[model samples]
Target: MKIGRIETFYVPPRWLFVRVESDDGAVGWGEASLEGHAEAVDGAFEALRDRFIGHDPRRIEDIWQVSYRGGFYRGGPVLMSALAGLEQSLWDLKGKVVGLPAWEMLGGRVRDKIRAYAWIGGDRPSEIADAAKVRRDQGFSAVKMNATAELDWIGTPRLFDEVVKRVEAAQATGMDVGLDFHGRVHRPMAKQLAKVLEPLGLLFIEEPLLSENPDGLRQIAELTSTPIALGERLFSRWDFKPFFEMGAVDIIQPDLSHAGGILECRKIAAMAETYDIAVAPHCPLGPLALASCLQLAACTPNVAIQEMSLGIHYNVGHDLLEFCSDQQVLTPEDGYLRIPQGPGLGITIDEDAVREAHKERHRWRNPVWRHSDGSFAEW
Candidate 1:
């Protein structure tokens, strides 16, 4: 079917959803947002929509090429995210026509259900422990939280004590706690934090420092045996080349929507597997994106676990599964969510819920933090 029109909505709690309608009745959905910047992503989609207006919605790879290589100055959060959404939408349309789920179309399932983790709050040790217990009670075997609220290049010993206490509280539940540095700590602090958390046992340390400096990443990697998982900020597979070649990272966390569409992320996952690095697709977004992640995880040999924001810290107005019609389809029983077995991206959007929530779309931006001396601090 030929592409008829592309529509977008900047939905609540910082998400942008795109709907691609074909000449026939086929429709596909995709989520492309980097927490903030929903409007920019929408503009990116609008600029690229003309290329697919009359093209076959089934030719996802060709459209991806046209949208990607089509722009010599390409591959940023806005463009790749936009292209990623369009590509996912096309795949959804194709899968629906063939009457198969995205994963099955991508060469069937590898595991029964991919293991997923919940996110616990950062900074508060007591609160984190209580949160871990709740998640464990709800059957989640793992939870991820920020290692620290904020940190300087070298913070106080009190901060380190607080970090250790948080880790201790989480470990009390006997559930693996993945500490996310959120790129808040520089290498100096990241190295020290890794050493401290090692005693408590960690699932992985996410973005210990930023992924910007690969050499610095190696420094953090050598300092601690805790698995270093990075690359949520990276937009393309090429961006991950140095990180992989360095052989420092034990796990690569590529967001399916940000890195590329399903096929591209699958290829990236395969590359990580060759490096003996595990894949845990980073998705703090919606169900369509989460479904795409699961599809890639299904065929990927090294996907250790998936990250889903069920009751995450940022769900002020919207949540995972609320935007979709088939919320029950994403039912997480005993910690793992069953893969969506229907055609296309598997889950269907509740247009009504989406439109209603879309009406109250939020202009969400991450808060900026500063140190006591009025110097900028990472948040």
Candidate 2:
């Protein structure tokens, strides 16, 4: 079926939703939430709408190739994210048309259920024990939290101790804890923090140093045993090539929504498989993004765990599953999210609610942080 109409909705609390309809009236939904930059992604879609309208919806790979190579300037957060959302919509529509789940179409189910983790301790990250307990009671076996707040390029030893204590508090609940440095820690401290947290037995240390610092990451990798998990920032498989080649990462967290869509991520996971690296997709957006992750986790063998934004800090007024017709479809059970067995992405969207929420339109932006000396610090 040819694509007839495509639409994007900038929902509250920072999310970008995509809807695509075939000429015959079949519809599909996908999320391209770029967190702080929804508007840019929405604008990037203008080019995609022009390119893909009246094109065949079932030609997923062909459409992706044209979208990527057709545009001389390609492969970044904005354009890739815009393409990612539209690509996911095409897959969903194809899966529905074929009367099979996306995973089934990819290959077949490799696992019935995939493990999931919840976010706690917000951006600054404190009072983690209570937060961990709450997640444990909610049937989560693991939880992740930011390692620290804004920090100077070089901080005192006490700052390291504070981060350790926060992680220890979360671990006290007998739950697996993954510490996300969130690129807030620079190379000087990133190496030190990884060394210090090496003894914690963490599930993983996410973005310890940012993906942009490959040399720093390799040095940090040499110093610590903790699985260096990054790649949320790397938008394409080409972007992830160096880290894998350097043997610097143990677990790669490719965001399905940002690192191209389902098929592209599957290909990335395949490349990571040769290095024996694990896949724990970085999804902290909405139900559709998480659902797309589940579809990948279902067929890919290396996927270690999935991140859900169910109660994440950034989702101020709107939590995950807010726009889903059946929230339970994407809901985690006993710490593991079951692969969706339904057609397409499996979860049904509440288009009416999405359209209604778009009316107010969120202008959510990430808070800019400054060091004690007033210099810019990563947030």
Candidate 3:
């Protein structure tokens, strides 16, 4: 059937949902949004509708190529994220048409369940030890927290002690703690964070330095044995080549929403396996996003863990599954999420819930910070 109309809704707590309808009667839904820039991605989604209307919705790969390379200026957060959402919708449509789950279409699952991790501590982390205990007590095998806040190019020893205290609290729980430097720690602090935190046996240190400074990461990697994980800002396979060659990273954390959706991430995971690195798909987004990540993680042999934003601090009034009709299908039980067996991306959106939340759509932007000297700080 031909695609008849494409409709989009900007929903609450920073999300955009796209619904594709065929001339016959098939309907599919996709979430095409970046956290703060949902409106920009929404605009990109509308721009691509010209190419999608009246085309075959089932032509997944062809449409993907048209939506991505079809543009002259290509592949950044807004453009690629728009394309990523559209690609996920197409996959959802295809799976529904075939009456199979996304994983079945992707060579089936390599493992029955994928280990999942929870987020603890907010942007500027505090109460990390308490958060870690809470997550573990609730049956999460692992939890991740921000490494530091507003670090300078040259930070003081007090900030290092603060980080150490946070690490010490998390380690007290005996759960795997993944310290995310959040790319806030520069070379000076990154080295210190890794050197001091390594003694705590961190599961991984995420984004020790920004992906832009792979050289910085190389130095950070050399200084510590803690597994260095990067790639939340990276878009495609080409963006990842430098990290593979550096041989410093122990894990790669590509956001399924940001890293070209499920199919391309599978390709990346395969590439990571070649470099002897593990995969932990980064997802601090909603349900459809997490579902898409799990589909990839289920089939990917290199995947070490999956990041879910179920109760993450970024989720204020809403959560990962706030819009879903059946939350259990995207279930995380005993700290592992079973691959969804339902058709398409395997979870259905509650349109009533969607429209209800749409009534008060969010104008969410993160807080900006300033240090004592009136210089801007990373938030």
Full-model lDDT for every candidate = 0.81, 0.88, 0.81
Which pairs clash in the backbone of model 1? 325-350
Tens digits of lDDT, candidate 2, 1-379: 7999999998878889999999999998888989899999999999999999999999999999999999899899998898889988888898898888999999999999999998887432356888888888867899998888765478888888888888888888888999988888888888888888989999989888888788888998899888889989988899989999998899998888898899999999999999999999998888888999999999999999999888645488677877888888777788998899999999899888999999988999998977777787787
**Candidate 2, clashing residue pairs?**
none
C-alpha lDDT of candidate 1 relative to the true structure: 0.81
Worst 10 residues of 2 by lDDT: 121-130
**Candidate numbers, best TM-score first, in rank order:** 2, 1, 3
- Model 1, residue 53: C-alpha shift (Å): 0.5
Put down candidate 3 lDDT per residue, 237-355, tens digits, no spaces: 77887899888688998877777777878888889999999999888788888888878877789998988877635587777777888899776778888888888899999988887
Listed in order, each prediction's TM-score against the native is 0.96, 0.97, 0.95
> Residue 55, candidate 2: how far off, in angstroms?
0.7
lDDT of 2: 0.88
RMSD of 3: 1.9
Per-model clash counts, in order, read 1, 0, 0
On TM-score, the candidate that comes out on top is 2
